[model samples]
Target chain A: LVDALTDRELTRISCGSAFREHFGAPYTVVHRRDLHGALLEACRKREEITLHTSKELASFGETAGRVLARFADGSEYEGAAMIGADGLRSRVREIIIGDGTPRPIGHVSYRGVVPLDQVKDRSHFDDMVIWIGPNLHFVQYRLRGGTVMNNVATVASERFERGERRDYGGPDELDEVFSHTTPHVREMLGYVGKDKNWVLHDREPRSGWTRGNVTLLGDAAHPTVQYLAQGACMAIEDAVVLSGKLKEAGGEINAALLAYEKERYLRTARVTITSRIFGDIIHCRGGARDLRNHLLAQRTPETFWEVDWLYRGIKA
Target chain B: LVDALTDRELTRISCGSAFREHFGAPYTVVHRRDLHGALLEACRKREEITLHTSKELASFGETAGRVLARFADGSEYEGAAMIGADGLRSRVREIIIGDGTPRPIGHVSYRGVVPLDQVKDRSHFDDMVIWIGPNLHFVQYRLRGGTVMNNVATVASERFERGERRDYGGPDELDEVFSHTTPHVREMLGYVGKDKNWVLHDREPRSGWTRGNVTLLGDAAHPTVQYLAQGACMAIEDAVVLSGKLKEAGGEINAALLAYEKERYLRTARVTITSRIFGDIIHCRGGARDLRNHLLAQRTPETFWEVDWLYRGIKA
Candidate 1:
């Protein structure tokens, strides 16, 4: 994987123990847009997968051994099994499991990329640095081959009302939430885009996802909170396992769907739940915050292998 | 009310300041089944109310300005508007809101009613005693006017598997969970019914509960965990408020339903979330547990009046 990237795109080397100790494995930092472009190009080359753009799902139903999907343009498509890989606000999911909406878990994040030279203090530009504090965290890392630095600052905002998604939160609120953090963290906050705040939302992991000839994948199935940074990784893993299960089932759609759900539900649920609990532990106040910092400060590369199961590819 | 009951059914009076100082309102101590029977009798006297038994709901739908409910026995009933007052496994709720099931919140309780004479200690029989401890709580109160002592002991069970409702927990497990409690609390636990234990389950407070001519009430709408003891109170309040809204709406079912939801959602949500948070606070461990106990012990009768809103009933 390291050999596939140019030297500039390779993960920058640094003496940041927080980065080196936590992720003992090789890491590369690429902008998510670039990663998506590469994967989309790879999909475009596959003759079996046809891409559809602007085809909004209106509703879906199953009948007479086929899954029928209707689009907003009044066109219909039939397939043996339909996979709902649509992101959050999924119409396929709404048709499958009616009416329940994703809930806001009272947190928001402001993210943007800045040219390295544009930043006044580029001290941590070569390293992934995460400053954890009470009810807030600031993460900065190099992206797009170190030419651009990506920053995500999240706060547990009481002002982020439940059931409402706001696209842009005021910069004053951002400053207030991060005012207590170190000067370096406050510096990273300056690079956040003017109107790019995302109010984070997630659904409680459902007990079941597959029903008959229709199933869900990726964010549609498990819209995990972004604390773990495993949302994309889990989705890619799901694609592999789901395809493998379908192939192994030999055209038995129901069996394949059941097998896929069984294989992935536990692992995905663990990841989602662990990530949420990790956020809770790191976002504690008073004594608990002290305990969390004391524990994190003691992390060493050998002892930080708890995430080996996550980094290592899924077992066959 | 006291004069209406026979001597054996009258509430036992004692010099306990806790009971007199806290409630400051009319109270009763009747077995739930008996109280339910009395309410049913009262409803039977009303010419407009009709009671249906053993009628399991199959499905329901609304059409032609009426809500049509189908029963498993092929019988059907249609009404201008329908209120789903069905309990936890409500079929009406399933028809209205699909696919989501109640989740177990990793707790279980053993409850039983023993004759007061059967117990060796009768020290606090006249008073409702609640013992809050780390990851466990014990509540005991008199019922049936002191003839029976109702004991409910709940434990935060690590052994309790998710999504599995165990009917009978082993005595050894029960003993292990309550082993750290005082001797008096342990004595109360000894009277737990041998073959009866309840697995507590609750859903996240849903944002909306009404659609068109149909709505939900009580546990069907918000199946709250029993920590707050407001489940029944909320349901009764729902009945009063829902009926008032319908009357005020002047035959407009949709408007009435929406009004009922608007009037009740915030209040019920506050109750449910507060109860869950109260449980979390009381169930803390180590330093947190000590803090909770300290706060609880220092609570005066006036201080406990924080729930005046709950007891005083919903405002018009």
Candidate 2:
């Protein structure tokens, strides 16, 4: 991590070795397409599994021994159980919890992918680099086995803060927000895609994800902001825990779902809450930013105490 | 409010007239003893009300028709329903919700009340004055019709931050913490009691404060840190709502308790959550504090837009 304004290098940890020592595996980052393809290949090997697409869920209900799901295309399916892995705007979650829409946290992110050969400074691009300034941060990392570079630039939107959500966080605003940063950071921002941006939203953590024979999984259960870079990681962890609970339940669907939710409630909530706090720490302005930088700079790179609770996976 | 380190006037809010115009009554500060006495006198005028002292609760349970509360002294009382107005360490809540002790947020406060004649700077004492610095704040205001001044000094304890809970916020540490502040803030700190200090704690807001014929109220339901100065105010609001619900229940205790909890859940939870966020905002350091001061200083004295949602009392 680097302070963008001062060009000062903040603390860096050897995450690969640290994660290997802690969890017997190195911390890994993968492209979404590759991960999704691998998981789909594994599912295709199973005789009982089938795949469907473009089937947006409309509603779901449970009877005495089975669950029924209705889709927007006017189709219905009955199954012994249901798992709502349908992400942030899940209709199943709305039917179960009904907490309304996720909250917009006044941040917008722009991302792009470029070939590694297009990079100007390969030395700085060798490892993951983050440039953090007041209310904005730019991230660079290699993906697809170092063949491509992933770039993400995020900023707290001034227009969003002023209560105009639409047309905010555009390419113009992105350039304006990062104009005060180092010229190197500004140059890097040029690689980011200007055609599209993502508005970040997160839901407050709540407990009741499982009801009857139906339950939620992954982002459907706990959607978090991208600050901690743990949204996909949490979803993967949820899959592992849910699978383990299913095996332990011996075909008892409701019990397995309930156990999964019970095990995941506090952990995922911690990630969601901590990610917001971490965002504030990094995007802080004025005196708080100085204190954050000062405190973070004094830490030893190899000291992984702060992340022990997070990186140390829960016992399934 | 003043920045103690820079001695800069950050913002001045005319809360007196603002609250008066908004609520038809001015925002009033009173000594705890006087407030308690007035409440006790009012309760004494009611024939059906009885006050008990030093009777610590051990546990409570509900039967088909009655709720039974057992005291630590082995005495038991049976009533139609039990309202756990018991405060922060509430045993009633322990039995009902079972969430553990309140979380310590690493803040310590010392308070003292002195006669008006003891104060050297009466001009600053006339209005509620708050001096904020990085990681610490000192507050002063006249109480009991200006016969006395209530002084409070609070700091984010270094020892507490370093994981030493005990012997952390003593007078010596207090002095060391405020040594960098302006002379006036330091002198005001001299009036704060040295012997006893308070460590702050609050709980994450959760639903389900009511079950059966039993329910929670006040800090027992949703304890908050003092940053917003709304702990007592929220508790009072709970009482009003609870009483109204009981009268509307028309002899149905379970209905009444559930109704009260439903009404107070979101509001009180909001206060608890916002208080923590507000604490972070006020106790900010580095660039965040600078931004806070700059933004707040731009506000008009009579602009109460930020507090409209809070100070606007709910309709019963």
What TM-score would every model get versus the actual structure? Answer: 0.51, 0.54
Instruction: Kindly list the per-residue Cα lDDT of model 1 for residues B78-138, writing each as its tens digit.
Output: 9998888887777777878764788777777888888888877766556766666656777
- Would you give me the overall lDDT of model 1? 0.71
> Residue-wise lDDT of candidate 2 within B1-316, one digit each (tens)?
8898988888887867666877676777878888889899999999999888899888777789698989989999999988888899888889888999998988889999999889887758568888888778998998888899899999887787766868777778788879999888888888989888998998877768888998998999989998879988888899999899989989988988888887887677767767888877777774356557756877988888777768887885
- CAPRI tier of model 1: incorrect
Error of 1 at B25 (Å): 2.3
What DockQ results do all the predictions give, each relative to the true complex?
0.01, 0.02
| DockQ of predicted model 1 | 0.01
lDDT of each: 0.71, 0.84
Q: Which 10 residues in a row give candidate 2 chain A its minimum summed lDDT?
A: A286-295
